[model samples]
Target: MSEKVANTFDGRLIFLMLSILLNVFFNALTVSTNMGSAVWTASAVNLAHLFNLSLGNTLFLEGVIVAIVNLILLGQFDYFRLFRNLIFIVPYSYLLAWFKQLFFAMGIPFLPIGWRFVLDLVGLTGVAVAVSLYQRANVVLHPNDDLPFILRFRFLHGSPCWSQWDSNIPPIAIIVVTAILTHQLFAVNIGTILNFVMQGYIIGWADQHIFPQLHHHLDFKSTLH
Candidate 1:
C-alpha cells in the first residue's frame, strides 16, 4: 500500500482500539450500576439466562447471526467484513467481562440508586461517543454496532436516531421472547429504557462534537467487490 493508505489504516486502527476500550468500559459501567444495559446486551443476558449459557458465549452467538444478517442487508458477501465482524465479538466479550468485574470490584454496583442513575447516563453517553468514533472510522465493528451503522448510512438517509430505533426491533423481540420463555427478564431497567430512547440522539450529537473531523470512510458500493 502507498504511504497515504498505510497512514490512513494506522489512524483507523487507533480509533478502532480506542473505541473498543471505551465501548467495553462504558458498557461495564452501565451494567454495574444495575440501572440497565443496551437493548442488545440485555437481550443477550436474557438469552443467556434462558439457555443457561454464559453471557460471552451468548454474545458471540448473537454477533455471528447479526454478521450474517449484515451480509443480507448488503445484498452480497464480503468475507473480510464478515470475518472481521465475527472476530470483533470474541475479544469484545472477554474485555467486557473483565471491565465489569473491575468495576464491580471498584464498588460501582454498591452505590446508592441515585448515584447509579447518574453513572448510567454517563455510561450511555460514553458508549454513544465510542460508537460514533469507530463507525466514522469505518474499520471493523462489533456486529451489533455494524447493524445500526449499515442502517444509518445505507437506508435511513444518515439519520442516526431512526436507524438506532429501527435496530432495536430485533433485540426487543428477542427480549420479549426470552421473557415469555423464562418468566423473567435480565438487564431491562431504567438504563435500558434510556438507551432505547436516547442513545440514537446521543450518537448524533457525538458525531458532531466528539471527533468533528473524523468523517465516515466507508463507501457502500466499493466494499462489495
Candidate 2:
C-alpha cells in the first residue's frame, strides 16, 4: 500500500479505538441511569399488568406507534440513524436486566424515592463527559450522536449560532428529556433541571478542552492537507 494511504488508515484505526473506548465508558454510565429508567418502565408495565393487560401488547403497539411517529417527523435518514446508537444497547440492556433481577433476588429495596434523582444526575454527567470526548476525536458518530447533527443541520441550516447549538443541544436534550419523560410516564422522578445544566456545561467544557489537545497531538490540519 502507498505510504499516505497506510498512514490514513492507521489514523482512522486510532480514532476508532478511542471512540469505542469512550463509548464503553458512556455505556457503563448509562447502565447506571437505565437502572432507574427500568424501574420506571417496570412500574408502568406492572400497572398495566395489574389491569390484566398483556405486556407484549403494550410493547408491540406502543413501540410501533412511537417509532412510526419519530420516523415521520424526523425523516428517513434521521430515523435510520437511531439504530447506530444501538451499539451500546445490547450490553447495557443485559447489564440492566441482570442488575434488576439481582436486586429483586436479594430483596433489595427500591432506591429511596429521592435518591433516584441523584442517580439520574450522575448518569447524565457521565454521558456528557463520554460524548464530548468522543466527538472531539472526530470519529464516526454513534447512532445517538447523529440525532443532534441531523436536527441541527436540517432546521438551522443557515445560522452560525444554530450550528454551535446544534452539536451540544441534542445530546443534552436527549439525556434530560429522556430522564424526565421516563419518570413522568412511570410516576418516578429522577433529578431536576440542575442536572441538565451541569451536564451541558461539563460537556461543552470537555469538548473545548479536548479538541484543541487532539488537534495538536494528531496534527489535524496537516493531516487534512
Put down candidate 2 lDDT per residue, 1-225, tens digits, no spaces: 343432463654464455555444433333333333322133424344444554334333333333344345465645333343343334333443455455445443355544545555565555555555544443344433433334444666523234435444433443446445544332233432343335446656665664334321123345555
Model 1 global lDDT (CA atoms, 0 to 1): 0.86
- Tell how far residue 82 is off in model 2, in angstroms: 7.9
Model 2 worst lDDT run, 10 consecutive residues? 35-44
C-alpha local distance difference test of each model: 0.86, 0.42
lDDT per residue as tens, model 1, 1-225: 343442376766787898999998998888788899988888888898999987778888999999999999999999988988977899888788788889889999899999999998899889989999888777788999999999988899989999999999999999999999988987789899989999999988988887676667776235334
Cα error, residue 66 of model 2, in Å, equals: 10
TM-score, every prediction: 0.92, 0.45
Taking all chains together, the TM-score of candidate 2 against the true structure is 0.45
Top candidate on TM-score is 1
For model 2, how big is the CA root-mean-square deviation?
Answer: 8.4
Collision pairs in model 1:
none
